[model samples]
Target chain A: MYRYDEHDQRMLDERVRQYRGQTERFLRGELSEAEFRALRLRNGLYVQRLAPMLRIAIPYGMLASRQLRQLAHIARHFDKGYAHFTTRQNVQFNWPRLEEVPDILAELASVQMHSIQTSGNCIRNTTADQFSGVAPDEVEDARPYCELIRQWSTFHPEFNYLPRKFKIAVCGSVADRAVVRVHDIGLVIVRDAGGATGFEVIVGGGLGRTPMIGTTIREFLPAPELLGYLEAILRVYNQFGRRDHLFKSRIKILVKALGADEFRARVEREWETTRRTVPPLTAAQIERARSYFTAPPYEDIDAAACAGALAAARATSRAFDRWLQRNVGAHRVPGYAIVTLSLKRTGIAPGDVTDRQLELVADLADAYSFGEVRVTHEQNLVLADVPQPRLFELWEAVRAAGLATPNIGMLTDIICCPGGDLCSLANAKSIPVAEAIQRRFDDLDYLHDLGDIDLNISGCMNACGHHHVAQIGILGVDKKGEEFYQISLGGNQGTDAALGTILGPSFAQEDMPEVIGRILDLYVAERHGDESFLETYRRIGIEPFRKAVYGASH
Target chain B: MALLIRHGDIVADDWVRLDAEFDTAAPLPPGKLLVPLCLWNARRAELVARDQPVGIWLASSEHPEAIVDALEDIALVAIDFPVFSDGRGYSYARVLRDTWGFAGELRAIGDVQRDQIFLMKRCGFDSFQIRADRDPTDALAGLEEFSLVYQSATVDPLPPLLQREVRRGA
Candidate 1:
């Protein structure tokens, strides 16, 4: 994890004091409600439908044991004893008193964490792959560049007040776990023929009411010019993006309105000046950031004993075998595996974890894995360096703590947001639909047979849950004051990201479980010889699914 | 009295903001007159015929490139915010100062507030017209708001990283 030095600490301390003063002014009635609203939002404080919600930035989903413990302490004291992890790899506390927020921020600052720029119309917390450094197929470790951007973007006067909120994601692996294609700016680490690595910068991609996949602005931007090119893109966006309406304010609209080629020309013109005028990202600085993410010490594994124990355990315990299949991924280092702690157990909100469970995960990280954990964009936790020898023991501990469920990327493991139940922006509640679907597919064997699938639900067109890019996307819409869900199919989040197509008129909230079931049933029957849902959908297109959902009326 | 913040202090504003109907057929405001971009374009020869202290005010929608060739003719270039969150003025100010090298006073006008004055100054604004509802004197605190910035702005083209490289070379 990137520890805060003196400079980082001083900036955070200043922000805490700044927020404290702003709160005092608001309470003293010196500031208007509307003025206070924008300021509070900049600090990640949202006045929800029922209570105040505060989002805490996990900084590319990396956390240490001490920081997790601090989060647990804050949740128990200030919030409703639990915190919900968001799809952006941040955590949200739903019930905090408006007056106590300054105190909460001060507490967070003590542990090198604050909510600055988490919710504001600024360069937000840049996210990267959860399995960043240890992924077997990764081209470069993206955390160094992410950390560099994090330092450069924080309190940047030129970009802090963009026309609208901006999101930047970086991907270092061939497989895009960070959903690079759906961000305001996405960078894919690539090595050219000469073996020198640079970034392929993609711009104007976002998932709002207008979902767009970004165009490659600079096909190969050298790593040294990262900040310069970013400033150019943001500078272009800040000036030209639509400001008359909030819904059409994202950079995607501007990119589309001007056409991608013209937008690229404008960015090139701006980059020529900014690249020289602004400070450069030196090789020394890049190497300094890389020092923070070096691999932890490991013990040599006894392959004979490990194989014998694994074979014995598999024969004796079907449950263990199922968990091994679903919850583990290959690690670059031999004899170790990346373990995913499932936050998507049925009857619970997709990513809500209790304070005790947080502390338990922290303790488990200290015990079995390294003393750090990574949060995934899919709202799960990762123990990146867990030794294979300690798998059974770690599973036993997490399962006893109610943090283990053998669903990682299965049908029942749904991605959802706290919708109308909590958020004021949501047209309908999303958790119930997610819960109903989870209950409908309770049989683990049936789910495993269904193969890999991504089901995402959003409360509204804001697309906070990323429904626009799921294999089966469900968007909640309000029709004549009634809550209804519109289904979309064939959306994907990999390198070939595409927006899902709508099926027809929406169904009532109660009919969502059956609707999802029908879509899955059609997929299961039509798939040829163990094809994934996405593969089958891509092979046959949306005709069959559309006909199944809307019926044979046509 | 209408006021403008200049060099971190509030002072009486003497410039007259002419409506689009700035009677080109009649005498212009006796003192410095600030007119919209279209009006300036329509009456540029006459406005500069006297060449008495004159300024131009641009809406956020208007381009700063209009003044690229006439930097010396205008004494002040004011950019409009329209609303606090609409940040187009910052970019316009940068283009005026950094690109065009417009050494005249760069003022931020319309809907400007205390919270934004710091960044407005960073973008090369030398003057501000705080909205009538807010106190202009309170905005003086915004000038010295932050001791450091992560990226270079119009105020200082060399951010800390560049400054570090300079020091190493020295």
Candidate 2:
């Protein structure tokens, strides 16, 4: 809900013009393919297998209704009437022509949106929890800090061409919903012992071929000094990060090579000077940013009326009861609840919303909640302010529109990436494998009985699907030019983040669904009263699951 | 011949670059020469005896802080971009210009092209050695690629929100 100011608007408009000029120059042969590739990638345009895929930045995953409409308009007019939400809380359109990308950017800018750093070796779109402001357990609203970072990193001169892409995640809550442990930099807002809120800055976390949990570099960085500390860290990485090999170039590699203690020392040395020269964020400036994210007006509701209506609805409709249990989350506001419009409907790709669905969601936001929508890293859409009284009606309408599957945080909810079907970097196709698993688990009752499970699949080790942090992680691999999958178990993404351990050899694509089924069956047989898959896996270890999937001893 | 672009115009250069084993080549007499970090660090006392203004050439892998003490004596500092994507030189230039207070000319050499002129200039590179194949004048337009910059640079060092202040005190 941060509206663009005059300066912000002008920058985006100028960026569109700049990109148009760059596109023209490239087309006219003033720029070679290799030279233009870096430039185009910086603008979030990737030359995929089919066509150019443009990843648009949904900064901190917040989108206004007007921006959503513009996205729908672009998809209808320029793309194939759909957009795929990414695991990084961004959106990707699959079929934009290379030449019309500037036009697409211009369209996005009209609604104060642009895909500036969605890709490339720069500080990418800073992501935060989707329920940033509305979550009851949150210590502070993270949107303002996210907005500040977005402004600072936009076209940053010093860090425009980093050694590798950098990702930063902000969390203001006790629960790690934003997957902070797997980002290059994770800032958890925390109050100091003296009660002044600052950030616990975690550095060097990443997921790819090598997944690393971030190391806490600073226990408590004063709130105003956040940007200064970040500059110092980037300065160190920009100078020391490996450039010899692409895979070894992430900040995580540098942190590992030099050791976290040495890396922190270097950053602190640089910060000693940077903190003095650069002005820390001022109270007035932070207040100005906070002003943009204040709560919307709400009418006081009668708790008795809401409870009576909810109980009545639950008694009458089992479907309503199921939907309420899975899709609704507690809101900070007394009479309100946060709703997730499931984009993981069966028979379709996870995290994908059609143009009509996008428009319909915008309409629903205007009707039930505020005219604001948030895209989650799980690839779901969030209606963050639906009133408790209106929950049942909204659920019915959304479910009828095919926007609801009642699978938020359920087993059927999957996080997947566009694999070998479209991605040039993928070693195997992931969509078919995801579809196979979703079809096998189509029984709603069975899925619910399975309890909270995080299922994620990545076409390759790029980890865009975030398979490394899932309870059941599937990574696509190539063997003798044949597509196969290697599964991992017991990974987690919450406060205690851990990478999954691989089970035995890779499985054939045809055998993947059965392999998953065997793993689930093993879990059910071994589980004790309400033990989640993660808990059971932790207790029983991977031996049982591995034996079940790959068969017993020789 | 390397065409040196200084102060936004193509200028004649007089600095001679000394390669490795120069000390063993002969009893070398130093003049307006740009020496590598190892040569300077190893033979500073003898090299500093030269009465002429000296310069240093920093490779992408070298840290600028290694010669912070000698930065005052150095008349020019040149940073190389091994590849356009290798951005170590930008941070090197920023460290020299913004943090270390190296006031002499900071030049970008090797693999730098017309399209990178804007970024090079923003990062405090006042002199450029454009790649041999491209026309330097055409690449000069890169310096004017955009009229506005969102974040401050060495050339434009005012924080966006604090521009009204008379001076930003350290």
Candidate 3:
């Protein structure tokens, strides 16, 4: 985790005080509602249906135990006893008094975190792969570059007010866990023939009303010129991106309008002029940032201990053995296993971590693993450096905390956004719909048998829930202020990213879970044993699912 | 007709006679120049060296880095506020004075609303070229936009960074 130095601490502290004054002025009726809205959003405070929602920045999803504890404390005091971890790897508090947000921000500053640029039409928090440093497939850890971007994008003068919000995701490994394909700018760090790591830049991919896979604008940009190239791209987008219609105000629209070839030419022209003029990134600076992410110390432990644990799991718990096989992954160092704490329990909200659960996770991280944790964009927590022998013990502890569900890749594991029940922008309440589906299919055996299905829900066309890329997508649409849910099938979020097709006309709120159950039942009946939900759905188009969902009588 | 020399456009004042024929190929007509905000760039240095008309207009996208070098050669630099809410050009004009060594006439053009003049002038923009359709007198009041700026900027060089660092002593 990147610890804040004096300068970082000073900046956060000053920003908190400034926001506090702004909040005070707004409360005193000194600032108009419209004027205060932009400022409040910049500070990550949203006026939701029930109360103000404050999103705290978990920069690149990396958190120290101390920071985790601070978040737990804040969740306990200021908000409802829970917080929702978002797809962008941020944590949102559903209930916080508008006046008290500043105090919460002040506390966050004390722990080197603030919510600047978390929710504004500005350069947002740059995301990266959760398995950044430890992934064996990695060419180089992308965190250093992500941090560099974080520093540069924060309070940037020229790019503060863009046509629309910008998202940049960087992936260092061959496999794109960060969903690099569907970002405003995706940088894949790759090593060229000479073994020098650089970036393969992809531009204009986004998912709003229009979903697109980003096109590669720069095949291989040298690492030293990353910032300069990025500047060129932003400069082009800032100057020419559409502003006439709010719906069309994204870099993708500009790129589409210009045609990828023309857009690429313009970006190249800008880069040619500005590349050498920008401030040079030195080796020392790169090394200094990299030092912050250096691997933690590991002791040589007996492999026999891990074997003994596995033997015990085999002897006693078949479910635990299955979970260990599915949820655990390889670590960079020997004697350690990377453990994923699944947030997707059967009937609970996905990515919603209660205050008590947060404290427990923090405690688990400190005890059974290295004092570090990561939040995946898929809405799960990761104990990155758990020792192999402690895996079962950690699983036991997590199970006791109600965090272990053994459904990491199953149908019950859903990704949902706060819909009309909370968010002003949402057309319908997605949380209850997700909850309904989960509760309907609470049987672990049934869920496991259904196999690797991604169920994503969004309350509106905004697609904040990433409904477009789920195997089973549920989008909430409003028909004359009454909530109706639309279902989409066969979407995916991997190397092969595809938008799902709508099943049929929208269903009523109560009918959603039943419809989803029918679709799942169809998949189970039609699927070849080894076929995943997406594979099975692709083999037989949306017609079968639609027919099953709507019924032949209709 | 007042012929404007944009930042990157060549000044052709000497070679081609505007009265007789306008040569699009050659640089912008030299002499006293009026430039649009859209054309300011590195090419300004060449125009400045030629001692053509000495006015530079800043585009809305133009940052402080664009005109930091040409401030000495040009007699006047005008900043365009493409949109009324766009405060970027204001910051650039301020940086021209404090950060870079720009000392000549500073003008505001484009969407120069009535409410922005005060802050524009406070930020060191002296001259106001209100849009052709807008009322200049009303727009001139825009110079008095903000009465107080809590944080210092390029116009007001000292931020809290240089201020006393709150020392606690006995």
Q: Output the worst ten-in-a-row residue range by lDDT, candidate 2 chain B.
A: B161-170
By DockQ, rank the candidates, best first. Answer: 1, 2, 3
Which numbered prediction scores highest in DockQ against the true structure?
Answer: 1
Per-residue lDDT of model 2, residues A1-554, tens digit only: 78876667887887788788888989999889998998899989999998999999999999988888999999999999999999998999999999999988989998998889888999999999999999999999999999889987888888988989999999999998999989999999999888898999999899999899999999999999988899899999999999889999999999999999999999999898678655688887677778788888876987678988999999999888888889898989788999998888888899888898999999999998889999999999999999899998898889988987888887678899999999999999998998999999998899889989999999999988899999999999999899999999988998999999998889999999999999999999999999999999999999988778767781
Label model 3 with its docking quality class.
Answer: incorrect
Q: lDDT (0-100) at residue A232 of candidate 3?
A: 73
Residue ranges of candidate 3 with Cα displaced over 4 Å: A28-30, A551-554, B1-74, B82-170
Query: Per-residue error at A100 for model 2, in Å?
Result: 0.8
TM-score of each: 0.96, 0.96, 0.82
Evaluated on the second chain alone, the candidates' TM-scores are 0.89, 0.86, 0.62
Per-residue C-alpha lDDT of model 1 across residues B48-79, encoded as one tens digit per residue: 88757888998888888877876788898888
Quote the lDDT for A553 in model 3. Answer: 62
Q: How well is candidate 2 docked (DockQ)?
A: 0.37
Residue pairs in collision within model 1:
none
- Tell me which of candidates 1 and 3 scores higher on TM-score: 1
Show model 2 residue runs off by greater than 4 Å. Answer: B1-4, B18-31, B38-51, B161-170
lDDT of 3 by residue, A286-346 (tens): 7666778888878797766777767887679877876786678887777788888999876
**Clashing residue pairs, candidate 2?**
none
